[model samples]
Target chain A: MALKVYADRMSQPSRAVLIFCKVNGIDFEEILVDISKNQQFSPEYKAINPMHQVPAIVDGRFKLFESHAILIYICCAFPGVASHWYPSDLIKRAKIHSVLDWHHLNLRRGSAGIVANILMANIDGHRSYPQVVNQAEGILLKSLSKLENFWLKDGRFLVGGSQPSIADISLVCEIMELELLSEKDHDRILSPFKKVVQWIEDTKIATSPHFDEVHGILFKAQKRFRERMKTQSNLKAKL
Target chain B: MALKVYADRMSQPSRAVLIFCKVNGIDFEEILVDISKNQQFSPEYKAINPMHQVPAIVDGRFKLFESHAILIYICCAFPGVASHWYPSDLIKRAKIHSVLDWHHLNLRRGSAGIVANILMANIDGHRSYPQVVNQAEGILLKSLSKLENFWLKDGRFLVGGSQPSIADISLVCEIMELELLSEKDHDRILSPFKKVVQWIEDTKIATSPHFDEVHGILFKAQKRFRERMKTQSNLKAKL
Candidate 1:
């Protein structure tokens, strides 16, 4: 039986895992557990992952969650995978692990928190708290600065490697969430960090069709959000 | 030359790494970076770890940060260490990774946030906001419940193994921060979770002298906090 992957493309981690599996040509069954519908909370799904977060996987009897773990597992469990994705060299792997561990409260927190606050404000018809938005933006920019000045200064990918590792994939997927914001807002937030913008593009090109395919849902959602905003403004003008 | 570890015992991750190195018999030098003194912000320290977090290591020319990564690196880089700490078995290692990744936003966040708020309130001479404490308590308890019901259900250590992995060390250290709370508050928060209490004891026994030694700073700090509280209450009575 093939490995079973439970994911929802709307989630950045989920997308990272899906793209990873696709790009690596790992045989797997894609099982979507839609968080929008609260499907992850179902008793059946909870059996697989009590945490109810996306990007879990089951390989035979072994079950796992946490997208970074899943990515590491895929690399280690599969024999055919190229070593560069999660290098066997102790220092390289350690550096990648450092990035992944640091990611949660830094890049992941900054990007996810900012996007969630913006989306919540739009949906609830309340102006987002400037302080909260500013705080998140500050953290996001600081993280980006670290990435540019340290992680990517010597090499094209995170960990100063010639090839992109899972760290690049995980982080880039996170930054990509900003596309849901208005074009002006998105550009304003990202424009100051030139290297980060280039790194994102490099990661995209490195991952190619798989990256685009996994992120298709996010693009669709962005379009829907834009159309709704346009319709609401048009109605206001008519009134 | 010995591996140089930068750490502060007051920080949980730093303590975890310190204990791991000592217990595992890894030769190392501990360089104290007193976060309370804002030593982590210094340019010299920043050059060692741009993230400016404790539990960084200099293994020859390679500098690494993040406690989890440091733990993994020690296990891998050093010879004669027990393999069970970071098993080479793919499934076992992957399960350990899952726990470490899940820990960041769950157990680590919940426990650290709660303790920090209480400490800040005491230091700043402001009553802690009850709502904030309550919310943090809720998250901490929820995380503990998951630990008792799921993670610890089948195993003496996390990941259903007889031996403790770095995951167990990382998590148990985070929970150990509750020792800083007043006796009544600590019991009130942790008393309901029977299994977690047992697990903490088990982990302590497994790690032994190193665990106790590293945690000595926290115990002394707790005593100081209690003495201050008693003095303040006595002065109020005299008034």
Candidate 2:
């Protein structure tokens, strides 16, 4: 039986995992657990991932969650998946792990939470509180600066390597979530980090069609979010 | 030359790394990077770890940070270190990684940050806002319940395992930081999760002297914290 990959393309990590599988030609089946509709909270999905978060995977009798873990597993377990994604070299692999570990509380925290906050605020027809938004933005900008000045300082990818590791894919997918923000907000946030911008582009070019294809849901959502915001503003102006 | 470990015993992850090294009998030099004194931000430490975090390792010319990454490296690179700590079995290791990755945003965020908030509030001589504390406590309690109900339900350690992996040490160390909280608050937060409590004890027994030795700083700090809280309470009563 093929591996079952439980995911929502709208999720950054889910998209990362999906893109990875595609890029490597790993045989798998994608099972969508839509978060926007609270499908992840259903009992059936909870059985697959007690945490009810994606992306998770079920292979034979084994089950796993957390995208980094899934990514590492895909790298280690699958044949013909390529070694550069998560090399066997101890030092190189450890450095890649460093980026993955650092990413959880740093990049993922700031980027993912802020996008959700903006969307929730839009849906609720009110701006997210300035203090909360600003605090998250502070973390996001600091993380971006670190990526620009330190992680990307030496090489083309994070952890100073020529090839994109799982770290690059994970971290880039996180940055890509910023695209969900308003054009001005996105530009204002990303403009300061020239190197980070270039790195994101580089990761996209490296992964190509798969990367863009997996992220298609996000683009559609972005359009819908903007439309809703415009309609809400028009209604307010009439009042 | 032995491996160099930059750490602060007061930091949970730092203690986890120290204890792991001692238990594994890894030859290492302990270098204190006092976070409380802002020593982590020093030029020297920054050279070793640009992220300016504790629990960084310098193995000859190679340097690495993030405790989970460092643990994975030690497991792979060192010859004598046992495999149970991070098994080579692809499935087992991935599950452990799942716990470790899930930890950062869930258990660590809730447990570690609350302790810091309590300490800072005490040192600055005021209470953390009730709303903020409650929110964090909610996250912490929910995370503990998840550990009790799911992760520890089947095995003596996390991920339904008989042996303690890096995930166990890293996570148990996080819960141990609750020792720094007042007895009332600590018990209030952890008492409900019977299995989690037992797992913490099991982990302590599994790692024994090394665990206790590394945690000595936290015990002393806990005493000082309680005394300080008592003094503050007495002063407020008089006022």
Candidate 3:
């Protein structure tokens, strides 16, 4: 049986896992669990992942969730996966793990917080809180600075590696969510970190069409959000 | 050269790494980074782990941080580490990875939040805010309940494995931080999760003397906190 991938493309980690499989030519079926509709809460999907989160996998009878875990599994288990993604050298792999672990509360939190604030504001028809946005931006900047100053100091990828690792794919997908922000807001946030921006471009190029393909939903959401803001501003002017 | 573990016992993940080393008999030096005194921020420690977090390891020239990453490195690189701690089998290792990843934002966050609140209240000499305490408690209980209903549903350790894995050590260490709470508060938060409690005891037995030895500081702090609370209540009675 082909590996089963449960995902929602709008999710950052979900997109990372999907793109990884595509880039590696791993055989998998994508099963969408729509988060906007709260479909993940349904009993059936919960059985596959009791945590009710995305980017879970079912390879034959084996079940797993957590995108980093899934990515590591794919890199280790799948035959054709290049070692650069998650190298066999114990030291290199350990460094990659450090980046992934650091990412959870740092980069992931910052990007997800900003996007979530945008989402909640849009849904409730309220202006997003300035303080909350500022806090998220602060975290995002610190994370980006760390990448620029330290991780990206030596090599094109994180942890000073010559090639993009799973860390690159996972983190790039997270920064991609900034697409949901207004163009000005996005630029203000990301423009300061030149290396981070270049690295994102590098990861996207390496993964090519798959990176863009998995991100289609996020792009649509970004476009829709911009349109909605414009319509709201026009209505206010008429009033 | 012996593996150098730069850590503070007061930190849960720090204790996790220490216990794992002791349990597996991994030879190393424990260079204490006293977090209470802000030693983690010192230039020396930052050079070791720019993230400035406890539980970093320097094995020969290779330096790494993030407790889960450190644990994984130790398991893979060190000889004679029992396979069950981090098995060579791809699938089982993947499942363990899932648990470790789930822990960061869930169990670790909840436990750390509650402990932080206690520290703030004690340091500021003010009664802890009820709502903040309630929020942390809610997160902590939900985490423990998940363990009971899902992860602990099958075996002696997490992920349904009989022997304790790195997941077991990492998580059990997080739960142990609740010892910082008042005896009443600690029991109130933890008592309902019977399976989680038993598992904590099981992990303690498996790791033996090192587990308690490393946690010696936490136990002392727990005792002092309890006495401080008793004195505060007694002084209130005079009114």
Candidate 4:
């Protein structure tokens, strides 16, 4: 029996898990739960993750959700892999936790605009609110600059002196989510953050050891999304 | 030198630290970074926390922030004290992490409505669009129901069927914040959530160690607000 990960590739957290597993060489089965199709709300998914959100894993009898928590567990559970990703020293680990905590309030929250505005625009046929869209844009831009000025600061990755920790994976997924989820403002919204664009490219190369499966699933998600968008109403209808 | 906590009791996360310190019988100097006073922006405070948020701490050369992270650090830093607040077992600790993660996305995100709608209502002198307030109010209600339904069920505390975890303290502060911040629609808007009201009372007893500080601050904030409301200009100036 293998570790069962209930997720859909479209979710940022799910992708974070995929990238982490690929980078760290963790073996787990990926169970797809399509959000656009409302598979997450079904009773079976609810039992594993009461919240009905994605990127949950059931390792033997131990079940875990919440991407960062799983990332910590994966890093801790599998020694020798991604040790620098989540350092062992108390202070370094705490710093990682600090950034992870701060990331939720900052990076994750800032990226909500990309989804609420652009995704909804494409799916619902409504022009998004300009102010909400602008504020979200401002937050992401400010955060990207802050990431550059304070958090990133020429470090190859996010926390400490680079080498891609969980923060990098967490944040990259958020930026990639726009592209991954095919947001209406994908190209326009993400173009200005040149630093982030390069960071993602750099990260792709850094974690290329398991690129075959990792990159394959990512591009597959993009292809599937592009195909799905042709008949948006069919998503709900398929469900 | 005492442990220095730079905080504003009015801020929920800061209040969480204040209560945690009070409950665990840890004495620390409370340095006020007044949110309304815009003290967080002062060059001195900004250096302390670049993001310029509240509830930060300094113990000798080490400094930390983020109430959840700080609470866990204090738990481990103080020998024989970590178990009481944050259980050390992998599962118990994971529950805390999982719940805290949920709080960040849902409860914390939802609580922003209180600040946006209630606290900052006067910033634009009612000149802002009505939809902003209405939308915030709507988010607040939905979030409150979420807090009540997803959590506060089959358990006295936020995490499990036992004593309060750091999650409860963080949550209490958020709920109490709605009242303390006194959104103009506090009565009509917040009065509907009875389950949350009951959960607050239940939590007070279970986590009785800090009940006084929790209620005391809640008491003082409202008292000050009521006294100031006697004058319209003062009411307009404060919040």
In DockQ terms, which candidate is top? 2
How do the residues A24-62 of candidate 2 rate in per-residue lDDT, one tens digit apiece?
999999999989899999999999999989899999988
Candidate lDDT values, in order: 0.90, 0.90, 0.90, 0.73
Candidate 3 local lDDT, A130-155, one digit each (tens): 77877887888899999999889888
lDDT of 1 by residue, B1-239 (tens): 89999999999999999999988888899999999899999999998998888979998999999999999999999996799899999988998999999999988878988888887776557788777778888889999999999999988888876888999999999999988777888999888889899889989999999999999999999899877867776887999
Q: Which CAPRI quality tier does the interface of model 4 achieve?
A: acceptable
TM-score of 1: 0.96
Q: What DockQ does every candidate get? A: 0.92, 0.93, 0.88, 0.46
The DockQ-derived docking category for candidate 2 is high
Off by over 4 Å in 2: A233-239
Clash pairs (backbone) in predicted model 3: none
Tens digits of per-residue lDDT, candidate 1, A55-79, equal 7999999899999999999999988
DockQ of 2: 0.93
- Candidate 4, residues B178-208, lDDT tens digits: the string is 6655445566656677767777787677667
| Poorest lDDT segment (10 consecutive residues) of candidate 2 chain A | A123-132
Candidate 4 ranges beyond 4 A from true positions: A78-81, A122-124, A180-198, A209-239, B119-130, B133-139, B146-149, B181-199, B206-210, B214-217, B224-239
How well does each candidate superpose onto the true structure, as a TM-score? 0.96, 0.97, 0.97, 0.83
Ordered by DockQ, highest first, the candidates read 2, 1, 3, 4
As for candidate 4, its interface RMSD to one decimal place is 1.5
Residue A40 lDDT (model 4): 90
Residue lDDT tens for model 4, A1-239 = 77788888767788788878867767778889999899999999887887789989887887788988888777766665757787766666666777788878677777866566855765657886778867877787677777767766646676656577777787777766566445545776666667667778777777776433545665776677666666775766788
Per-residue error (Å), model 3, residue A236? 4.2
